[model samples]
Target: MERFTSGAHEFLIPMVFYSLFCLVLTVNVAGAVSIQDDCHERRCNNHEPPVRFPFRLQDQQPPHCGYPHPGFQLSCSENKQTLLKLPRSMKLLVKRIDYDARWINLYDPSRCLWRQLLDLNLSTFPFVDEIEPAASYTLLNCSSQDEALYKGNRVDCLSTSASQIIAFRSDGYAYLDNLLNCSMIGNISAPISPYFFRFRLKWNKPDCGDCEAQGKGCRLKTNSTEDQTECFYIPKHRISVRERLMIAGIVLGSLILAMIFIAVGWRYYSEKKKKEGLLKIEMFLEDYRAFKPSRYSFADVKRITNHFKDKLGQGGYGTVFKGRLSTDILVAVKVLNNFKGNGEEFINEVGSMGRIHHVNVARLVGFCADGYDRALVYEYLPNESLEKFIFAARGKDRSLSWERLHDIALGVAKGIEYLHQGCEQRILHFDIKPHNILLDHNFTPKISDFGLAKLCSKDQSSISMTTARGTMGYIAPEVLSRNFGNVSYKSDVYSFGMLLLEMVGGRKNIDDTVENTSQVYFPEWAYNCLDKGEELGIRIEDEEQTETAKKLTIVGLWCIQWYPVDRPSMKDVVQMLEGDLHVLTMPPNPFASTDPTKMGATIPRKPVNRELPTIPEIE
Candidate 1:
């Protein structure tokens, strides 16, 4: 009976164990089939946002669920939290995605800190391999002092303390911490919310391989980086089944939600951008309306200037073309070089001339400010510039008659005086030279090119200048010397004196040559000639010529005194030019006679024992 009981127990035990193993196998198969079926045909519920490509829940899993790319993976953290792991160092907490807009809103962990997230080499994640050129991320709390460095070069920080959106053409995912120092003290205690430091990411093509290989990341979304296909490298590791399944489900769910959000956000952003563009156009139009410039289209300008066929002259800014606008109406059109980036000059000339009505100043008839092209149209004067007449060979013989010279001098003086007192503000002709003075049909002198003109107040006698303005030889000594008080309107007077000296001598004031061992400055030469009983060589065919030359020389000496106080004002200069010659005095030598042989000569020519009089301050 005992043997029979033992036999039954062994048989029953074996059958029971086998039955339990089969039940467990059946359950496992059913579970795998259910999960696979759910993923294959399940339609995402509208109530819970739809999941897009590159993302899928583990419950409805497919082989290419999270991403087809090897390094891309999405996972659910504690409490079904979604996290996206990119190729490099980028790890984004998935929020919502918009399939239509092809964008995802992500929580930036470094947003609460003083530094930037991208600046911290956040582009290292492998999952961000699909960011687009139009894709941009908004930076928060950026300031003027805060500059962005992409790779090794610094990039312009668009805003300070405002969310800055940057767009790129290709994928920027890559690890850069190995190449750059991205270490920062993070504010881990900062508040976290649904929208805590969220930034949008659009799909972009990868372009910077070297940078990615070198482990450097892009700072901005634009083409600021040298290459765009670069991505950061991340170490691979095995993940557990539970962790992988949970993460995949969360990532898929989050990706679906992100697509919906991105679509709505993109539509709003596009509309806002359109409105901003319109506003900018409106503002530009309003600013342009203040000065009513005769507008000329490109075709009209080409026609007026005979297809820019006739060249007048080329300058630092552009080339001037002579054109016939109408019957008996000729114009000089200056076609500015596109590379000469001086829009302020255009604005200054237009604004100053539009408000001023001076006979001695050139008139602006029209202008063109087309894309990459600028042109200025002025009434063409038959007579060229004053330099052509003054610096000619045997200038006195071919010179303007004494009557015309006198009239031109007076006109120039009047123009200068008007700039000093006629207008509400005092205008200083910083660059007063023969080249800037134009001539009319009647040989009348008219001031042109106010590019270097400085408008100051009458009460403010002096203005601060970092560097000397005007032609080198014509620049006043006071402008270069800090000991000579501050520069004022008298500085222009000094320049004018140099110009007058050139006019009288028919040559430059200072000419250095190996033959002329003795420095023959025109002012000093004239002074010495007058001091010595030599033929003033006053080459004058007519009595008018002799008188005009003598008068101009004497007046030129008086204007170019050593000190500003000694020099006469433009008003006094005009009066002196119009007055009789007998009233003019033999002015003192401007540059004290310095023997080149003397070593370290600092003292002026006077009594060795007596002290020179102190120079007065400029008014």
Candidate 2:
């Protein structure tokens, strides 16, 4: 009897469990779906507002999650901002949404709501402003002198130096007597709120007020063909002992599958990205190997640089380290950073330098493009850059003789000329300053750092440039503004001209530390001094040295003319620098202008040099 009782109890328990599992599987096979399965509230991002009925996030929620009508859709921007596209292609950012109030606050993505209001046509949209009465406002373009009249009401962004825009209520236009100077540009009818640019919009269609009153959620009917909605009781789903076990198994299995997929996908993506980068470098090297620059391995680079022991210098591109191939042969190895603008700077340096061989141009000994590591091996210059010697202190013995300075200047100009015309295609050294000029033991200047260089056809007079390039003070006026002239080889000439002025004055072209505010800009002060025929040096006894200073100043001023056409080419500059001092003529005052303020007493006076007794020659 005891054995029979135990056996029967075990069989009954197994049967009950098996029967329940069969029933649940049959229910699932019958296509029974929960009413509130996918229509639940969802958000694009945690910071963004949750969306439900009458509005839905397009890609995130199903079609039935939102009302089946126009203007009820929302999307997430790449930056995770909630976005709503209004009529006439006006896309605005959804700042906030109040579900109970049935209103949403919207602001323009461009941060210029007035510009959107200019072309706004909201008749096609479902939302409307019910609080503030829509009023017609006349946009007025008035002279900047009348900015005080509009004060806080002025659109600062739309306003320029010559004119300003003011929004005036159209009804009060006839009453205002001081609007004669303001010309009406256009008229827009929008809600006038104290918030100015931002406004609130409310929707009235498919209202869910009754559901809120009953403390229940509302949604459209699942099976009904019509646009019928019903208030639903928010069910608290309670899991029984058996149901809890099933749910636990399903969740654990899903998590395992998800983790496996993620691991495999991440590994595949990493390998593909690495392969693509290495393939790109290999393809480039295949075409560039003919240039005869040796390619080194990563291990070889580390060995040559002595594991990056001796630090040389660092800049925007990367860090340089003093390295050696042998005890007798030395190399300056520049270990490039991973963020090489996607290898743009590295490619520019290698591609431009590989095609040229000159006495004044730095030699590219070898390079390493292994996996993620990159380095450029260059002929190490014992004297480092010309910047170290040129801007030496007042009493320092680093200063060079006038003749030596002339030779360095000529060498740099010749190197620039070679880059422009000596190559197969013209290579424009967008950045040309003393910092880039490397010097050997004999102080022979070699142009280095071709990261900012650009290559174009030799006959292409003006290269198309969407954005400005080069150092701040040395950038050509034409590069900053097309009004001056097109950007060409003449751009480099302007940079060289700035370098020349800095060399001659023994100070920066723009020095704000001087006691005299007027003479802060050295180029203008030097031009004024040369124009007045004043002595540039206070204690220079040699006449030849003074002449040399004057010649360099004149050449620099001529090269920095406001217009590119007015500035001499590098070829002409070379001739002027090498010619006799008497043959050189005074350049037109670059600072001279037709503007009254410049011509008046506000113009900068002569610079006072009390630190140095002599004009320091550039090394």
Candidate 3:
């Protein structure tokens, strides 16, 4: 019994000390909380500074909460804005209040603080501007056209439409003596800041500076005492050494525990994600073994591209870099921006480019899928994209001759043709804009950027699409709306048509900056010129160039027919490009019948199966 009692005493002594320590801490916290709760800080809104002792909300706080003065009392406006109304009812928003600094920041709620300053009387207010000293400014009404008037010193708000109100500094009156048609209105004495955006004011009475300096808060000695303020130690503001040690120990212990939990969770999650990524990569590699394009690691890609030092271009999907494979071979590396985007873009580019081997279609050299990083490598064309050449400023070095442009158009058509028919499964190049058309050193155009490509069987005429794809101007009407027709290979024809028109016009199809308003929509305007037998408005040096422009314009109009079924197939387009310009007739004015009711009137009631025309194939 004695031994048991001794053991109980040993345990009870420590328990008693712990209970006392907890009690003391609780009391200290409760005391601090109670002091704050007695005259709690109030705010008009979340953005405004808290109003407390030395400054209090008029209706919200009691009379004993703040200094006994009109300036110390702030009010919440109807709009929930903290407002400090001056002597003349000029309300200024209370932006911030620093009890320690003994300063209050204010700005005119009306935006023009200078207008208020012109007639401000600060004698009644408890605050005075220590930063901005009082100065005299002469107001002058000057003529609007007076060149001698200092325009920078003019008050735009006070001036009329016909005249400028110049607030000339009194000390600099020598420069304003020669002003034309200027009359001095009056002189006003006011505190002026450099830029009257914010007004800062300091106070002397109910001084809490000493208490704040000593790390204590000041309160009235008694509720009735207006003149006397006594310093009181705020436990939260000035914590004891014992409390600091206790808080530090608790924080340190919590942090160590949290760190251990986080480390374990992160390790488990990382291993799981790593395993899943490896499995995905293995499956991707397995599917591409037969195609056998080189697979590069992220490190290898960085090495090949010189740490992404030389950038070629950027698009919505990724940034392309100029890279070298060897001494002689150069490649363009496209580092995808969102490699985790359902893995659609990366899959589309690789899968679509993997099967094809065409002279006009850009060749994929390799790809990278190391960890989170993904990139596609392609053969680098020295001339960049067709956009640089066609859409460039006039007289630049990248401008191509009409003949070269015609050839490029033909090459692009062939590339699209191969995408529609040449492959085992027809590939649809959804995005076929000038930016996607890359040109080699010899100016041969190649279709690139198949990020939006879709695959369907050769026999399938139309495919189901839930959402619209491709650049805005180049997207087919059918793709945007089913009323035009079902989307199919014909959509590519429409995009190619838009591309063709852009190439011919040396501008986009929907150019708004053209001098003639009628010519703003280039395709519509080009058709009007073609229909009227007028020379295309573009600069044409010779008859041959005019004929080339007409041919491309006519083909573009035909391809962009509102109804997909009304548009020609890629094969027909290829033949049309290779054939004589005179043989091609203007397509049934596609833009003429825009109304839903008149659509069938101009368009064919049914898609007529036109006999395919043959032309000599390009070698």
Number of backbone clashes in candidate 2: 0
lDDT of 1 by residue, 1-619 (tens): 3564476466557555655655565565445434322223222343333443345544455644334443234555455556665433445566776544445666756453213334433333332423222233323222223235332222233322443322221234233343233322222111112123565665432333344446543112334343223233433335559656755654564565457457645765776799899997987676457434586767788999999999977766578889987988888888877444556656665566555446787667777767667777877877867888877864456576666767777788888888888877778887788887888787778887665677777777777777776778777666777465467888888888878877777667765532453434556766667667443554468766777877888888888775676789999999999898878887877656544322112233432221223332222
Residue-level lDDT of model 3, residues 463-523, one tens digit each, is 7788898998899877887767677889999999989988888987766676666766777
Estimate the TM-score for candidate 3: 0.49
User: What shift in Å separates residue 539 of candidate 1 from its native position after superposition?
Assistant: 1.6
TM-score of each: 0.47, 0.49, 0.49
Q: What is the lDDT of residue 471 in candidate 2?
A: 89
The numbered model that scores best in lDDT is 3
Q: How many backbone clashes does candidate 1 have?
A: 53
Clashes of each: 53, 0, 0
The candidate 2 region of ten consecutive residues with least summed lDDT is: 610-619
lDDT by candidate, in order shown:
0.60, 0.76, 0.79
Which segments of model 3 are wrong by more than 4 Å? 1-292, 340-349, 593-619
